[model samples]
Target: MAFKLPVHCPSCETMLSVSQLSCPECSTVVSGNYDLPLFLQLTRDEQDFIMQFILNSGSLKEMAAQMGNSYPTVRNKLDDIIGKINQLKNKNGKDDD
Candidate 1:
Protein backbone atom coordinates (compact mmCIF):
# COMPACT_ATOMS: atom_id res chain seq x y z
CA MET A 1 0.00 0.00 0.00
CA ALA A 2 1.13 3.49 -0.80
CA PHE A 3 1.49 5.84 2.16
CA LYS A 4 1.17 9.61 2.30
CA LEU A 5 3.81 11.65 4.08
CA PRO A 6 2.75 14.10 6.76
CA VAL A 7 3.50 17.68 5.74
CA HIS A 8 2.12 19.41 8.83
CA CYS A 9 1.53 18.87 12.53
CA PRO A 10 -1.87 17.35 13.07
CA SER A 11 -2.54 19.27 16.25
CA CYS A 12 -1.31 22.76 15.42
CA GLU A 13 -1.30 22.54 11.61
CA THR A 14 2.24 23.89 11.49
CA MET A 15 4.36 22.94 8.48
CA LEU A 16 6.98 20.25 9.16
CA SER A 17 10.51 19.72 8.00
CA VAL A 18 12.23 16.40 7.58
CA SER A 19 14.75 15.65 10.34
CA GLN A 20 15.74 12.15 9.33
CA LEU A 21 15.47 9.64 6.49
CA SER A 22 16.51 5.99 6.57
CA CYS A 23 16.87 3.22 4.05
CA PRO A 24 15.05 0.04 4.97
CA GLU A 25 17.33 -2.34 3.09
CA CYS A 26 20.76 -0.98 3.98
CA SER A 27 19.87 0.79 7.19
CA THR A 28 21.61 3.89 5.87
CA VAL A 29 20.44 7.12 7.44
CA VAL A 30 20.58 10.83 6.73
CA SER A 31 19.53 13.60 9.08
CA GLY A 32 18.92 17.32 8.71
CA ASN A 33 16.38 20.12 8.83
CA TYR A 34 15.32 19.53 5.24
CA ASP A 35 12.72 21.65 3.52
CA LEU A 36 9.82 19.85 1.85
CA PRO A 37 9.79 19.87 -1.95
CA LEU A 38 7.45 22.25 -3.76
CA PHE A 39 5.00 19.51 -4.73
CA LEU A 40 5.03 17.86 -1.34
CA GLN A 41 4.15 21.14 0.31
CA LEU A 42 0.64 20.99 -1.13
CA THR A 43 -2.26 19.37 0.69
CA ARG A 44 -3.07 15.70 -0.02
CA ASP A 45 -6.12 16.54 -2.11
CA GLU A 46 -4.12 18.95 -4.20
CA GLN A 47 -1.48 16.31 -4.74
CA ASP A 48 -4.07 13.83 -5.87
CA PHE A 49 -5.53 16.36 -8.26
CA ILE A 50 -2.12 17.07 -9.69
CA MET A 51 -1.40 13.38 -10.18
CA GLN A 52 -4.66 12.96 -12.04
CA PHE A 53 -3.95 15.93 -14.20
CA ILE A 54 -0.52 14.58 -15.07
CA LEU A 55 -1.85 11.10 -15.80
CA ASN A 56 -4.27 12.69 -18.22
CA SER A 57 -1.27 14.13 -20.08
CA GLY A 58 -1.89 17.71 -18.99
CA SER A 59 -4.97 17.99 -21.13
CA LEU A 60 -7.62 19.94 -19.26
CA LYS A 61 -10.41 18.55 -21.44
CA GLU A 62 -9.28 15.00 -20.80
CA MET A 63 -9.03 15.66 -17.09
CA ALA A 64 -12.51 17.14 -17.10
CA ALA A 65 -13.87 14.03 -18.74
CA GLN A 66 -12.09 11.71 -16.33
CA MET A 67 -13.16 13.77 -13.30
CA GLY A 68 -16.75 14.19 -14.58
CA ASN A 69 -16.33 17.92 -14.16
CA SER A 70 -16.97 20.66 -16.66
CA TYR A 71 -14.08 21.95 -18.74
CA PRO A 72 -14.16 25.35 -17.06
CA THR A 73 -14.10 23.68 -13.64
CA VAL A 74 -10.96 21.74 -14.51
CA ARG A 75 -9.41 24.86 -15.97
CA ASN A 76 -10.15 26.75 -12.77
CA LYS A 77 -8.61 23.98 -10.69
CA LEU A 78 -5.47 24.11 -12.82
CA ASP A 79 -5.35 27.88 -12.43
CA ASP A 80 -5.64 27.52 -8.68
CA ILE A 81 -2.81 25.00 -8.54
CA ILE A 82 -0.66 27.25 -10.72
CA GLY A 83 -1.31 30.17 -8.36
CA LYS A 84 -0.29 28.10 -5.35
CA ILE A 85 2.86 26.90 -7.10
CA ASN A 86 3.81 30.48 -7.97
CA GLN A 87 3.25 31.50 -4.35
CA LEU A 88 5.52 28.71 -3.15
CA LYS A 89 8.26 29.63 -5.65
CA ASN A 90 8.06 33.27 -4.60
CA LYS A 91 8.27 32.32 -0.93
CA ASN A 92 11.29 30.11 -1.52
CA GLY A 93 12.93 32.81 -3.62
CA LYS A 94 12.52 35.28 -0.78
CA ASP A 95 13.91 32.79 1.73
CA ASP A 96 16.98 32.23 -0.45
CA ASP A 97 17.74 35.94 -0.62
Candidate 2:
Protein backbone atom coordinates (compact mmCIF):
# COMPACT_ATOMS: atom_id res chain seq x y z
CA MET A 1 0.00 0.00 0.00
CA ALA A 2 1.11 3.50 -0.76
CA PHE A 3 1.43 5.91 2.13
CA LYS A 4 0.64 9.59 2.01
CA LEU A 5 3.67 11.84 2.43
CA PRO A 6 3.81 12.98 6.03
CA VAL A 7 4.06 16.71 6.64
CA HIS A 8 4.52 16.50 10.39
CA CYS A 9 6.27 14.27 12.85
CA PRO A 10 4.06 11.37 13.81
CA SER A 11 5.44 11.22 17.35
CA CYS A 12 5.87 14.83 18.43
CA GLU A 13 3.76 16.62 15.81
CA THR A 14 6.66 18.77 14.68
CA MET A 15 7.25 19.86 11.13
CA LEU A 16 9.26 17.42 9.00
CA SER A 17 11.75 17.81 6.20
CA VAL A 18 12.71 15.50 3.39
CA SER A 19 16.10 14.10 4.28
CA GLN A 20 16.79 11.77 1.41
CA LEU A 21 15.65 10.53 -1.98
CA SER A 22 16.63 7.41 -3.86
CA CYS A 23 16.56 6.57 -7.53
CA PRO A 24 14.76 3.31 -8.23
CA GLU A 25 16.68 2.49 -11.37
CA CYS A 26 20.24 3.53 -10.56
CA SER A 27 20.08 3.26 -6.74
CA THR A 28 21.53 6.74 -6.50
CA VAL A 29 20.80 8.63 -3.30
CA VAL A 30 20.72 12.30 -2.42
CA SER A 31 20.26 13.75 1.05
CA GLY A 32 19.18 17.19 2.16
CA ASN A 33 16.59 19.05 4.15
CA TYR A 34 13.71 19.99 1.85
CA ASP A 35 10.57 22.02 2.35
CA LEU A 36 7.15 21.06 1.19
CA PRO A 37 5.34 23.31 -1.27
CA LEU A 38 2.80 25.71 0.17
CA PHE A 39 -0.10 23.60 -1.07
CA LEU A 40 1.33 20.48 0.52
CA GLN A 41 1.25 22.21 3.87
CA LEU A 42 -2.55 22.32 3.73
CA THR A 43 -4.56 19.75 5.63
CA ARG A 44 -5.68 16.72 3.67
CA ASP A 45 -9.29 17.82 3.94
CA GLU A 46 -8.43 21.20 2.50
CA GLN A 47 -6.57 19.55 -0.34
CA ASP A 48 -9.57 17.38 -1.06
CA PHE A 49 -11.77 20.47 -1.02
CA ILE A 50 -9.52 22.08 -3.60
CA MET A 51 -9.70 19.02 -5.83
CA GLN A 52 -13.47 19.04 -5.59
CA PHE A 53 -13.63 22.73 -6.38
CA ILE A 54 -11.48 22.19 -9.46
CA LEU A 55 -13.52 19.19 -10.60
CA ASN A 56 -16.62 21.35 -10.39
CA SER A 57 -15.02 23.90 -12.66
CA GLY A 58 -14.71 26.46 -9.88
CA SER A 59 -18.47 26.52 -9.34
CA LEU A 60 -19.20 27.28 -5.68
CA LYS A 61 -22.84 26.31 -6.20
CA GLU A 62 -21.85 22.91 -7.49
CA MET A 63 -19.48 22.37 -4.61
CA ALA A 64 -22.17 23.35 -2.16
CA ALA A 65 -24.57 20.88 -3.69
CA GLN A 66 -22.04 18.08 -3.72
CA MET A 67 -21.00 18.73 -0.14
CA GLY A 68 -24.62 19.07 1.05
CA ASN A 69 -23.87 22.57 2.30
CA SER A 70 -25.11 26.07 1.56
CA TYR A 71 -23.39 28.22 -1.03
CA PRO A 72 -22.22 30.52 1.73
CA THR A 73 -20.65 27.63 3.55
CA VAL A 74 -18.69 26.57 0.51
CA ARG A 75 -17.72 30.16 -0.16
CA ASN A 76 -16.54 30.56 3.41
CA LYS A 77 -14.38 27.48 3.09
CA LEU A 78 -12.93 28.81 -0.13
CA ASP A 79 -12.31 32.14 1.54
CA ASP A 80 -10.49 30.42 4.36
CA ILE A 81 -8.31 28.56 1.91
CA ILE A 82 -7.61 31.78 0.04
CA GLY A 83 -6.65 33.49 3.27
CA LYS A 84 -4.23 30.71 4.11
CA ILE A 85 -2.64 30.84 0.68
CA ASN A 86 -2.32 34.61 0.89
CA GLN A 87 -0.73 34.34 4.31
CA LEU A 88 1.80 31.83 3.03
CA LYS A 89 2.60 33.99 0.03
CA ASN A 90 3.08 37.03 2.21
CA LYS A 91 5.33 35.10 4.54
CA ASN A 92 7.39 33.79 1.65
CA GLY A 93 7.65 37.27 0.18
CA LYS A 94 8.84 38.62 3.50
CA ASP A 95 11.45 35.89 3.71
CA ASP A 96 12.71 36.80 0.24
CA ASP A 97 12.89 40.47 1.13
Candidate 3:
Protein backbone atom coordinates (compact mmCIF):
# COMPACT_ATOMS: atom_id res chain seq x y z
CA MET A 1 0.00 0.00 0.00
CA ALA A 2 1.19 3.50 -0.84
CA PHE A 3 2.00 5.81 2.01
CA LYS A 4 -1.01 8.02 2.79
CA LEU A 5 -1.29 11.07 4.94
CA PRO A 6 -3.24 10.65 8.16
CA VAL A 7 -6.00 13.13 7.43
CA HIS A 8 -9.38 12.93 9.08
CA CYS A 9 -12.58 14.91 9.12
CA PRO A 10 -12.61 17.52 11.82
CA SER A 11 -16.31 17.05 12.39
CA CYS A 12 -17.10 13.38 11.84
CA GLU A 13 -13.55 12.10 12.28
CA THR A 14 -13.66 10.19 9.04
CA MET A 15 -10.47 9.12 7.30
CA LEU A 16 -9.68 11.22 4.25
CA SER A 17 -7.79 10.30 1.11
CA VAL A 18 -4.91 12.49 -0.01
CA SER A 19 -6.10 12.50 -3.60
CA GLN A 20 -9.64 13.40 -2.70
CA LEU A 21 -10.79 16.83 -3.80
CA SER A 22 -13.67 16.74 -1.35
CA CYS A 23 -14.52 14.67 1.69
CA PRO A 24 -16.82 11.74 1.00
CA GLU A 25 -19.10 12.76 3.87
CA CYS A 26 -18.44 16.50 3.95
CA SER A 27 -17.36 17.29 0.43
CA THR A 28 -14.33 19.27 1.56
CA VAL A 29 -11.20 19.32 -0.54
CA VAL A 30 -8.67 17.29 1.42
CA SER A 31 -5.66 17.27 -0.86
CA GLY A 32 -4.02 19.50 -3.41
CA ASN A 33 -0.66 20.91 -4.46
CA TYR A 34 -1.33 24.23 -2.81
CA ASP A 35 0.78 25.05 0.21
CA LEU A 36 -2.09 25.31 2.65
CA PRO A 37 -3.64 23.38 5.51
CA LEU A 38 -5.80 20.34 5.01
CA PHE A 39 -9.57 20.74 4.62
CA LEU A 40 -10.08 18.50 7.64
CA GLN A 41 -9.61 21.52 9.84
CA LEU A 42 -13.24 22.28 9.15
CA THR A 43 -16.05 20.03 10.23
CA ARG A 44 -17.64 17.56 7.86
CA ASP A 45 -20.79 19.63 7.82
CA GLU A 46 -18.79 22.75 7.16
CA GLN A 47 -16.93 21.04 4.37
CA ASP A 48 -20.12 19.82 2.80
CA PHE A 49 -21.60 23.25 3.18
CA ILE A 50 -18.63 24.82 1.42
CA MET A 51 -18.66 22.38 -1.45
CA GLN A 52 -22.35 23.00 -2.02
CA PHE A 53 -21.84 26.73 -1.71
CA ILE A 54 -19.14 26.71 -4.36
CA LEU A 55 -21.13 24.42 -6.62
CA ASN A 56 -24.08 26.79 -6.31
CA SER A 57 -21.91 29.75 -7.27
CA GLY A 58 -22.10 31.20 -3.78
CA SER A 59 -25.83 31.26 -3.82
CA LEU A 60 -27.07 30.90 -0.28
CA LYS A 61 -30.59 30.08 -1.40
CA GLU A 62 -29.42 27.15 -3.44
CA MET A 63 -27.11 25.91 -0.74
CA ALA A 64 -29.85 26.13 1.86
CA ALA A 65 -32.14 24.09 -0.29
CA GLN A 66 -29.51 21.49 -1.00
CA MET A 67 -28.49 21.25 2.62
CA GLY A 68 -31.98 21.51 4.06
CA ASN A 69 -30.86 24.45 6.11
CA SER A 70 -32.04 28.02 6.44
CA TYR A 71 -30.55 30.74 4.25
CA PRO A 72 -28.86 32.50 7.13
CA THR A 73 -27.27 29.29 8.32
CA VAL A 74 -25.90 28.52 4.91
CA ARG A 75 -24.65 32.06 4.50
CA ASN A 76 -22.95 31.98 7.87
CA LYS A 77 -21.22 28.73 7.03
CA LEU A 78 -20.01 30.17 3.72
CA ASP A 79 -18.65 33.20 5.50
CA ASP A 80 -16.76 31.02 7.92
CA ILE A 81 -15.25 28.95 5.13
CA ILE A 82 -14.29 32.06 3.19
CA GLY A 83 -12.69 33.50 6.26
CA LYS A 84 -10.58 30.38 6.65
CA ILE A 85 -9.50 30.56 3.03
CA ASN A 86 -8.58 34.19 3.48
CA GLN A 87 -6.55 33.37 6.53
CA LEU A 88 -4.70 30.68 4.62
CA LYS A 89 -3.99 33.08 1.79
CA ASN A 90 -2.67 35.69 4.19
CA LYS A 91 -0.43 33.20 5.88
CA ASN A 92 0.91 31.90 2.60
CA GLY A 93 1.54 35.44 1.40
CA LYS A 94 3.47 36.25 4.54
CA ASP A 95 5.52 33.11 4.14
CA ASP A 96 6.40 34.03 0.55
CA ASP A 97 7.41 37.53 1.59
Candidate 4:
Protein backbone atom coordinates (compact mmCIF):
# COMPACT_ATOMS: atom_id res chain seq x y z
CA MET A 1 0.00 0.00 0.00
CA ALA A 2 1.17 3.49 -0.69
CA PHE A 3 1.61 5.79 2.29
CA LYS A 4 0.55 9.41 2.35
CA LEU A 5 3.29 11.92 1.77
CA PRO A 6 4.07 13.84 4.95
CA VAL A 7 4.09 17.60 4.54
CA HIS A 8 5.73 18.68 7.76
CA CYS A 9 8.54 17.75 10.09
CA PRO A 10 7.31 15.77 13.06
CA SER A 11 9.44 17.50 15.66
CA CYS A 12 9.64 21.06 14.43
CA GLU A 13 6.45 21.11 12.41
CA THR A 14 8.26 22.83 9.58
CA MET A 15 7.37 22.03 5.99
CA LEU A 16 9.23 19.03 4.62
CA SER A 17 11.25 18.99 1.44
CA VAL A 18 11.50 16.21 -1.12
CA SER A 19 15.11 15.14 -1.36
CA GLN A 20 15.07 11.99 -3.46
CA LEU A 21 13.06 10.26 -6.14
CA SER A 22 13.37 6.79 -7.65
CA CYS A 23 11.91 5.30 -10.81
CA PRO A 24 9.98 2.07 -10.42
CA GLU A 25 10.51 0.94 -14.02
CA CYS A 26 14.28 1.49 -14.05
CA SER A 27 16.34 1.49 -10.87
CA THR A 28 17.38 5.06 -11.60
CA VAL A 29 17.31 7.50 -8.68
CA VAL A 30 17.45 11.26 -8.64
CA SER A 31 18.39 13.29 -5.60
CA GLY A 32 17.65 16.95 -5.03
CA ASN A 33 16.07 19.20 -2.47
CA TYR A 34 12.68 20.44 -3.59
CA ASP A 35 9.56 22.03 -2.19
CA LEU A 36 6.31 20.26 -2.88
CA PRO A 37 3.72 21.90 -5.11
CA LEU A 38 1.29 24.31 -3.42
CA PHE A 39 -1.57 21.87 -3.79
CA LEU A 40 0.31 18.99 -2.23
CA GLN A 41 0.98 21.11 0.79
CA LEU A 42 -2.73 21.28 1.53
CA THR A 43 -4.38 18.86 3.95
CA ARG A 44 -5.55 15.56 2.54
CA ASP A 45 -9.19 16.43 3.15
CA GLU A 46 -8.66 19.61 1.22
CA GLN A 47 -7.14 17.67 -1.63
CA ASP A 48 -9.99 15.19 -1.67
CA PHE A 49 -12.53 18.00 -1.63
CA ILE A 50 -10.83 19.60 -4.61
CA MET A 51 -10.78 16.27 -6.42
CA GLN A 52 -14.45 15.68 -5.74
CA PHE A 53 -15.28 19.18 -6.90
CA ILE A 54 -13.51 18.48 -10.19
CA LEU A 55 -15.24 15.12 -10.54
CA ASN A 56 -18.53 16.90 -10.04
CA SER A 57 -17.70 19.24 -12.90
CA GLY A 58 -17.08 22.17 -10.56
CA SER A 59 -20.70 22.17 -9.50
CA LEU A 60 -21.11 23.39 -5.95
CA LYS A 61 -24.61 21.93 -5.78
CA GLU A 62 -23.37 18.55 -6.90
CA MET A 63 -20.55 18.66 -4.41
CA ALA A 64 -22.97 19.53 -1.66
CA ALA A 65 -25.17 16.58 -2.57
CA GLN A 66 -22.25 14.19 -2.80
CA MET A 67 -20.81 15.34 0.51
CA GLY A 68 -24.18 15.47 2.26
CA ASN A 69 -23.57 19.09 3.06
CA SER A 70 -25.52 22.26 2.42
CA TYR A 71 -24.68 24.24 -0.67
CA PRO A 72 -23.43 27.15 1.41
CA THR A 73 -21.21 24.80 3.38
CA VAL A 74 -19.67 23.46 0.22
CA ARG A 75 -19.23 26.99 -1.08
CA ASN A 76 -17.56 28.03 2.15
CA LYS A 77 -15.25 25.04 1.98
CA LEU A 78 -14.30 25.92 -1.58
CA ASP A 79 -13.77 29.53 -0.68
CA ASP A 80 -11.49 28.51 2.19
CA ILE A 81 -9.43 26.33 -0.11
CA ILE A 82 -9.15 29.14 -2.62
CA GLY A 83 -7.94 31.45 0.12
CA LYS A 84 -5.33 28.90 1.13
CA ILE A 85 -4.12 28.50 -2.43
CA ASN A 86 -3.81 32.26 -2.76
CA GLN A 87 -1.84 32.47 0.46
CA LEU A 88 0.53 29.78 -0.71
CA LYS A 89 0.94 31.52 -4.02
CA ASN A 90 1.70 34.82 -2.36
CA LYS A 91 4.24 33.22 -0.05
CA ASN A 92 5.96 31.53 -2.96
CA GLY A 93 6.00 34.75 -4.92
CA LYS A 94 7.65 36.53 -2.03
CA ASP A 95 10.17 33.76 -1.69
CA ASP A 96 10.99 34.05 -5.35
CA ASP A 97 11.34 37.77 -5.09
Clashes of each: 0, 0, 1, 0
Off by over 4 Å in 1: 1-3, 94-97
What alpha-carbon RMSD in Å does predicted model 2 have with respect to the real structure? 2.8
The better-scoring model by lDDT among 1 and 3 is: 1
List residue ranges in candidate 2 displaced over 4 A: 92-97
* Candidate rank order under TM-score: 4, 1, 2, 3
Superposed by TM-score, candidate 2 places the C-alpha of residue 49 at a distance from the truth, in angstroms, of 0.4
Candidate 1 per-residue lDDT over residues 1-97, each given as its tens digit:
9887888899999878889999999999999998788889987888999999888888989988888999999899889998988898797774331
User: Clashing pairs in model 4?
Assistant: none
Best by TM-score: 4
Clashing pairs in 2: none
Q: Write the per-residue lDDT of candidate 2 for residues 1-97, one digit (tens) a residue.
A: 9999899999999767778999999999999987667788788999999999999999999999988999999999999998887887786564421
Q: Positional deviation of 5 in candidate 2, in angstroms?
A: 1.7
- Global CA lDDT computed for model 1: 0.87
- Any idea what lDDT model 2 has? 0.87
In the range 7-97, model 3's lDDT, one tens digit per residue, is 5657897544445467679777755544325465455676777677678887889878877999888777777887876675575565331
- Cα error of candidate 1 at position 85, Å: 0.9
lDDT of 4 by residue, 8-51 (tens): 99999998989999999998999999888888989999999999
Question: lDDT for every model?
Answer: 0.87, 0.87, 0.65, 0.90
